[model samples]
Structure formats: structure tokens, C-alpha cells
Target chain A: MNDSQQNIKKNVLEKIRHGDVVMRPKIYFTLQVIVVAVVAVCAFIASVLVVSFAFFSLHESGELLLLGFGVRGLLTFIALFPWVTLLIAVGLVVLLEWLIRYFKFSYRQPILKVFFVAVCVVCVGGLLITFTPLHTNLSDTADRGDLPFIGQLYEDVHMPHEDKGEFRGVVVSVATSTITITHNDHDADADDGTRVVTVPTNFNTSILHIGDRVYVAGDMTNGTVTAYGLSKF
Target chain B: MSDSHPPYPTDEELVTRVQHGDQEIFGELMDRYTEKLSRYGRQFLARPEHIEDLVQDVFIKAYQNIQSVDTSRKFSSWIYRIAHNAFVNALRAQQTAPISYFDFDTFTAHPVYEDGHAERKEAEEMRVLVEKGIKKLDQKYREVVMLYYFENMDYQQIADILHVPIGTVGIRLSRAKALLKKELPVDTTHI
Candidate 1:
């Protein structure tokens, strides 16, 4: 070998023999990549969940329950649907893609390819998550006064409660202290319509009958409606 | 007399041997890449200062971090990627250029249109023309040019080294070739 070549080899060998650095095991980098991939997947799954809620809200329309909203209602529903949940879902997935840039392979990939793949994965996962029993459990917990803040959010999307203290429900039972009412599912406001209301200690309770459809104006605390005024629908 | 070795072992085989407690074999690998990688670094840096130090640093780093690589991959790509990063980081530290400022969002290069299959010329002339053309390109395109022409790597290999899609490798090469054709013109016979 030439002098310069010999010199390079000598210098390289010197560095290696110094013992100042250790070669990390290949498995550790592999594990790190695996961990990053798992985190990305988790972000994707969470994004799907947010999208599922948006799907459930769209399901709020009574017509969609039967799988036919007709053209006009469908158009209006699309126009008026609060898109925050879906928007947040999309934002979340995009953020996950941004996170993917940390990976050597992902950062080098075309943005379109990554984005398309991410959206597809999220949509498929989101649809499956939306159909799962998770939403049901959340709704149940929300009605039970367990979750903070967003608990009432679930109740509002799935049930019709008037902004002006009005609640519509079918009277399930009659009692002197409290009358039980299942929320009116057919009302335009309550899509799935499953919130239960206990109307308590109102003077108009004497007029309420079993199975009577009624509208009560009241404060809902822990999913119970306390009526200041009551009327028969 | 017939030789027991298969002329030269493939890079993958060499790596397997290295992983099997064969530290000495790594020097052989370094000898193979030293000249080529040094040229790549020189072209990238566009200056002739501490290039030997840069090349030596790549060897040292690659050796120290050898175990971190997924051995299933082509060793050359992994090492080249390390070299590429080292070069880019060194250049970026000088504060001249950020890596990716080109808006590739709208740029889609047509492979067939940019293919230079008809660009027939002598190897020496082609080499000179190519070197000049590559120097004129932005780094994004330059790396692809070097890998394709100087290193004689396939599109897939280039993709692996650069961490881009296989199609992206083709596209970048195509765009680089188009840029070259603009910088220097030539005539060729198509059969």
C-alpha cells in the first residue's frame, strides 16, 4: 500500500484501540425504532378515537339511525355538523406524521406517501374504534357523573337538552319525590337519545302520568332534571 | 491453482464475519470505501481541507457504531448514510445552506423523459461532463448524481442510502440528469 493509505489505516486502528468508545448492540437501535413506531401507532389510534366520536355525532340524526337521512336532511346535517372532533382527529394524525420525521426511513419518505398511508391507517382504525363498545362505556360513565368536562359533551351530542333549560323525555315512572324520564330519542337534537332524567319534587309532578311524554324546564345535575316548570307534550 | 475465496466476499458476508468477532475484517471494508467516500466528501464540501480527517472520522464512527446497524441491510448503504449525515452536518454547521429548501411538493419528474439512454459518449468525456454537471446541481440532486455515476449504485441502493422511496431515487436521478442536460448538451445515436 502507498504511504497515505498506510497512514489512514494506522490512524483508524489507533482510534479503535483507544477503548474510549463502545459499539452499541444492533438490537438497541432496532428497539428504539420499534418504540418510535409504537408511539406513532398509539398516536394514530388516539386520532382514530377522536374521529369515531365525530362519526357518532354524525349518527345523532334520527334519520341516520335508519340509514337514510334523505338528500335535504343529509345536506343540512353535513353543513351544520360541528366538525371540531373530526378536525382535531386530522390534526392529531398530522402531528403524528410530523413525529415520524424523527425516524431515518420516515423522514426521507415523500410527504404525500406518508400522509396518504397515515390517513388510511387512521380512518380504518378510527372506524373500527367508533364501532367498538368504548363509546357506550363512555356514555354510561358520562351519565354517572364520572368523567370531567367532556362527560357532558357526550351527553349533549347524544341527547337533546334545550339551551333554555328544557328537556324532553318519556315519563318512565311516577313518584312524589322524583319522576324518572328517558330522554326523547326522536327529537331532532338528541341523535342517539339515551340520557335518563329524574325530575324531582316539582309541584307539577302530580300531573305527570306513567308513560306520558313531557317537556320539563329544569337544571340537570348528575344527569337528573330538576324542574322549575313542567308541561305535557 | 484454484482459490478458496470467491474472488471477493459480498459486503453482506463481510459484515456477518465482522459481527462474528472478526474485528480485523473491518479494516478491509474501510480500505474498499476510503477512496470512494473521500471523493464524495470532497465533492460535497467543495473544498480540500481536512477531507482525510472527515473520511477517517466516518471509519471510526462506523466502527464504533457498527453493532447499532441492522445487519440484514446492505452495509454499504448504512455506512454511506452515516457519511452523508456527517458531511451534511459539517456543512450545516458552517451555516451556509439548510438541507431541504426546494419545494418538492409540486415537482414530479418523468423518468422516461429524463432518461439519458441516448447520451452516448466516450467514458472519459462522459466522466468530465458528468463531474461538471453534478457540481452545478443542488446537493439534493448532487448526491443522487454521485451515487448513480461515480459510485455505480442502483436506484434501490441509492434509495436505501438516502432514506427515500425507491421511486424517489428514480425521480431525483431523473431530475438531476435533466439539470445536467441543461448545463451541458450532447448528441447520441439511438438503436
Candidate 2:
């Protein structure tokens, strides 16, 4: 309210009136708005995709630690989880919600409420998106080496644990720290592969009920495979 | 606000005129809000120099995106929302003076006022202390206090401007006052 400040403001207005500054063309603002909208939507979709990817990854990394690599490989596999994807997903969701805060209506509601609602919607959308054939289609595309980064990400997440030992069969026996699996890769043919493999696992081994389709990875010699990794196929 | 536009026009009508290419009315808006926005910017923004720039930027942006304005909503809230975003981004860009990095988490949790209802009193001394307290508070608290008292906006209006729930507006205001009451050593009524 000082005389000097008021004079400065009046001078600024006079300058504005006398064409010292020009308003941006209408199209520029329109384009800016359009770009913001597009970025917000893209951020939302990315969050959903990354969140779903994390979901599937978590589902695969069972709590049962198979002692095939003497817990080292188990530790590695656990660490190599789609954590980055999950983290990025969370970060994306937060970003999208933040962007939404700029909108007229979004600000009327509490941000925590907006954030929780946005997160739930994104998670549900991600789950529904997972049900699409896109996952399989993506895998197929990744298999042919068509997509680059996505292919690598898909390979890292979905490709069976081939780095160690890869075998799928049904559990025949369950011990305190070990589960015996009968290997049967080729069906309706002669028994060429290992007949049985004893896989040492963590204490939550009660999940290894006999007749369950299971996959195990470890050292296999003369049909005796000392397992390191185990998962429900 | 008139700028020779006859009797006062609603902000929505003025914005409509701008949308229809009557861009001069945008200046009317600039005239109306510049001082208010400047005061608001000073409350939370660390750099006082950027406040005028921020106000000018907000007007330019508002002028540009006049088409996107929803006529049903209050035009003042819409523009205030822009100012809020501008200040927030300005603060974020000021990495050298990183003030209250976690202020956004103000709405992430409980409404402390819900458990303990906050009383509304207006003491001249309290008001002065509140002004000093605003500068000392965190970004989130300072904003709600400024929006509530300085800008003379209600909780819903504050929520609309800040994009938070109305309840969050109350919680923030209450918590902000409590912090002020504690920090400024005002009459102690807040639990």
C-alpha cells in the first residue's frame, strides 16, 4: 500500500496498456493445456502397467526359499524382483495424482482422499489390464525380438528360471526342509529325464503338498537334483 | 476490475469474453488479482522477487487457457489454483533453498482436528501473531493460513484452490494455528 509500490504497479499497468508486452497467441495456451492433459494420462497408464508387472512378479517370488544355490541364489532371485517396476509404478501414480491436483475439481477434495482413490482406481485398472491378452502378446513379441526395452523387461520378469536349473513336475514327497519332485517334461513317452529330485526349501514347506504341479531349479545329476529354487508352475 | 467494461461482470462472463477473443478483459482479471496473489506468494515463497513474476505468469497462463475454464466453477478459485501451482513449482525449482520438502504430506494422514475440534477466535493480537507465525510455519500450513485469513476464503474455497479435501483444509488451518500458538507464544487454548 506504500506510495512507491502503488506507483510501480500503476506504471506496470500503464506499460501493459501501452503495448510494452504482448499476450501469447491463443493457440499457445491451448497447446499447453493439451500437452498437460496428455502427459497426465500417459503417466497414469505407465503407473498401471508398472504396478501390474510388480504384482505378477511378487506373486512369482514365493516366500519358500529353495536351497539349491545354498541360499545365495535364493537371495539374488529375491533381490532381482520387479522392485524397480513397482517403485516406478508407485512413483508414476504419485506423479499423476500430483498433476491432477492442478485441475479445478481435483483440488476441492482432500489430496489424501484423491491419492487413495486414484491409487485404487489405478490398481484395479492395472489388474483388469493384466487380464488382457496383451501380456501374452507382449511375451510373443518379446520372444521374436521385436520390442527392445520391453522385451528385456519381459524376459527378466516372466522367463522361467533358466539361469540355474529348470524342471517342472509334481511333488511326490514332502519333508521338513525338502520336497521330492518327480520330473516329467516329456509326457506319454519314455522316462528320459530325472525321475525324482529332492529340493531343500524353507520352513514354509507345508505348501508342498504331494500332487501339486511344481517347478524346481538346482544341481541335477543322475536323476538326483539338489534344488535351489522352487515355484508353483 | 471494470477497465471500462460497464458495470462489474462475473469472472466467468469475463473469461467467456476472453475465450471469444475479447482478450482485453484478461487484463481486468490481472488488475483484480495481482495484489492478492502477490500477498499470497509472499506468505509461502522464499523468494519475494519471484512473486510478481509468478503473478504475471499466472495471468498470462490464464489468458492463454481461457477456453479450458469451466464456466460453472468459480473463476477466482480456478486462477488461485494456477497461482498455487506456480508457487509450488517455483519452490520446487528453488533447490538451493529447499524449504519443507515433505510439506505435500500434510494431507497424507489424520485430521488432528477431527479428534479435537478447533475453536475459531479472532483477536487483534492473535491476528498479528498469526501473520508472524505464517512466515515461520511450513509451506503447507502457511498456505492454508494465508488462503483462509489473508485471501478471506472458506474451507471449500481453500480446498478448491489447493486441490485438497475440505476437511484437510480445516485440519491444516487448525494444525497451522496450533503450531503458531506454540511457536509464537500466544494465549494457549490449542491442545
Instruction: List iRMS for all predictions.
Output: 3.1, 4.3
User: Candidate 2's residue-wise lDDT over B1-191, tens digit each?
Assistant: 65776767888888888777765676676767778888888876877776766776776666655677778888888899888998899988875766554445445644534322233346444467676677788788888888777776777777778766667787787778778878875354332
Clashing pairs in 2: A68-A227, A68-A228, A107-B163, A109-B164, A109-B165, A110-B164, A110-B165
Q: Give the Å shift of residue B124 in candidate 2.
A: 5.8
Worst 10 residues of 1 chain A by lDDT: A61-70
Candidate 2 at residue A158, lDDT? 40
After superposing candidate 2 on the true structure, give the runs of residues whose Cα lies further than 4 Å from its correct spot: A1-20, A25-30, A50-80, A105-119, A140-196, A199-214, A217-223, A227-232, B1-8, B18-31, B38-71, B79-96, B107-128, B131-139, B163-165, B183-191
Clashing pairs in 1: A60-A191
Candidate 2 per-residue C-alpha lDDT over A1-233 given as tens digits, one digit per residue, 9 for 90 to 100: 44534544555556547766455566776787788789999999888887776665544433233434456656655655656777788789889978886665675555677778989998998888777776757766765677687776655444334345555567878777666766543223344243365655553677778898776666768757776666675
lDDT of 2 at A29: 61
Highest lDDT, which number? Answer: 1
Cα displacement (angstroms), candidate 1, residue B69, comes to 3.4
Best by TM-score: 1
